[model samples]
Target: MENVMLRDVIVDDLPIFFEQQKDMTANFMAAFTTKDPADKVAFKAHWEKILNNEAIIKKTVIFNEKVAGHVSSFEQFGEREVSYWIGREYWGRGVATKALSQFLDCITIRPLYARAVKDNIASIRVLEKCGFEIKGEDKGYSNARAEEVEEYILKLS
Candidate 1:
């Protein structure tokens, strides 16, 4: 489990977060990703906006005292949805499961929602393990893969 922990994301964490998201394999698995992962300017601008927003619940996923990735909640299409990213090097070993479990405890908003690429079993398993139930399914254009992909929608109520 690597003593996974979640804490408020700080400005210093942006570089690591950006680097992690740039991983081709991780972004492909996530499916829904920035239009250009390599665009540092865009990444910085995006994070700046997200971090400054008070309505968002953002956290850095720490493992063994190092930044493993990030987990956050934000509104999309009038729904409060959750999302997380785990560095490719730390994939598996239950990092995502532990981080989400801990993160869920800090968030009290009921009927929380989450989504994952249908083919991303690792992410689906993490959400399911944290008590998110499969609610529905939909298809969307995945910028990371540059194609349409099935996405699983889940909720915690």
Candidate 2:
């Protein structure tokens, strides 16, 4: 297995994260994303809120000493939820599964939730591998897809 580790997110990691999110394929798979992924100002503002928020548990994912992406847990719609973003280059190397596993160890909250676009089989698989089960479904506007997208809601308890 690759040496996937999760650590505190730093200012330096933001650029890599920004570039990762700009990938069209990733944006499509993620579906519910920023309306403008290329808007650096919005991206910065968003990260500032995440970094400064005391309630959000955010971590940078490192693989072989390089920043691969990030994982975080935060409250959304009054429910604790988890999310992750792995660079396209790191897509199939088990980076997300291992990083999320490490994150779950630190976040003790139960009944955690996660959502993935219905067609994003890879993401759903990662969630399932980490002990999350599909519990419901939802539909929402997706800026990436530029339309309403169906998604699966998964829960870990």
Candidate 3:
């Protein structure tokens, strides 16, 4: 596969973004809570807000010249943190790690935080590979799964 790259999400990319989001939510329903079609619609609306919002930094993750997923950093709980998702079809290919590392390089910030569902070993590994250290854990509601789940927190300093 071609190397993963990150670029600004443009207006024209919304369709791909929406499709990827649906695929990801369906594939990881246990970790997310957007199983219901209505919930998925709401999720898309939320992403629309993120796409237009100036405060959030969102980028499309490209692999082999195709849109694979998205990476972003946004202010939450008083800290600027990073988060990303790679499509199920592209998992285990190092695309997320490379895209995330590149995203972090572009955004200059200290004490960056990331969270992954406790069961998502791959995501945890990606964060670790990118130099993030586990700091703690918390219970949170996941939209795709429709239940509260254990989340592992990682910090980069």
lDDT of each: 0.92, 0.96, 0.81
lDDT of 3 at 146: 64
Candidate 3's C-alpha lDDT? 0.81
Q: Higher-TM-score candidate among 1 and 3?
A: 1
Superposed model 3: Cα runs more than 4 Å off:
24-30, 33-44
**Alpha-carbon deviation at 133 in model 1, angstroms:** 1.1
Q: What order do candidates take by lDDT, descending?
A: 2, 1, 3
Maximum-TM-score candidate: 2
RMSD of each: 1.0, 0.8, 2.3
Q: Per-candidate TM vs. native? A: 0.97, 0.98, 0.87
Candidate 2 Cα misplacement greater than 4 A, ranges: none
lDDT score, residue 65, model 2? 93
In the predicted model 2, the residue pairs found to clash are none
- Give the CA lDDT, 0 to 100, for residue 93 in model 3: 86
**Which digits, one per residue and each the tens of the lDDT, describe model 3 over residues 93-124?**
88989999999898888989988889888888
